[model samples]
Target: MSEPVIWREPVVEEWIDYNGHLSEPYYVLVFGHATDAVMDAVGLGPAYRSEHDASLYTVEAHVRYLDEVSLGVDLEVRSSVIGVTGKLLWIWHEMYADGRLRATEEVLGVHVTGGSSSPLPDEVAAAARALLVEAPEEASGQIALRR
Candidate 1:
């Protein structure tokens, strides 16, 4: 099997906030792009959506920001398919900058067509399953108050 896809994005000036750091929403945006890349890798990309009106809809996401990022840095996101079902997919992405883990996002997406959940194509399902790995320990966890 091939290695999983790594999505990369440069931190542009527009993504910075008044605090002189990467903004909160841009992290989600980068993760969203990573999700799209995964869909494309599994044959659920724009072509598939246009052909069958089927697409993956993110129903939930949990993002953990572990460090602040500055502008002009290139961010790399490594994505993995942690779990997959006939109609649902669970993916995790780790964002890194300067060789350090900066953030992580775990997403749950459902295959949808005509506004209803539907089973993924057999080929796509198999492809997604091929990429599955053990879920991260922090995945699906809630932010707890540090006492």
Candidate 2:
């Protein structure tokens, strides 16, 4: 099992919306950064990209906004692997600001060839498993409205 990866991101001006809160696209960007951190922890980073010519791509994503995040607020995004099957991995991410749950995202990604959407190789699957972290039977200290 692996520990949760914590990523800190400060809200930027471009991320602000008409409501004076972080925009939807920036939320995805934060999630994307968290995903990269996880990948690096799993031994799949730029080196792996160059060596294996492989990488993971998001195929599906669902995000639920529980609270609004304003600019200048420092946010923390925690991520962990929920499940993995074949070449597909399920990831869960939570955004927190001032220790409050602000948003949650469930993402499904598939490992593929660097330049194309092809199934991952056996070695990639094995490597991913080595870093796989079993999701808790239930996440504590956070309210999850969308499961």
lDDT of 2 by residue, 2-49 (tens): 667889989989889999999998998998998888778666689988
Q: What CA RMSD would you report for each candidate? A: 1.3, 4.4
Cα lDDT, model 1, residue 35: 99
CA error at residue 36 for candidate 1, angstroms = 0.5
Specify the highest-TM-score model's number. 1
For model 1, residues 1-147, the per-residue Cα lDDT tens digits are 346679998999999999999999999999999999999999999999999988999999999999999999999999999999989999999999999999999999999998899998999999999898889799989878999
lDDT score of residue 116 within candidate 2: 73
Backbone clashes in model 2, listed as residue pairs: none
Supply the global lDDT for candidate 2.
0.80
Candidate 1 Cα misplacement greater than 4 A, ranges: none
Taken over the whole model, the C-alpha lDDT of each candidate is: 0.94, 0.80
TM-score of each predicted structure versus truth: 0.96, 0.81
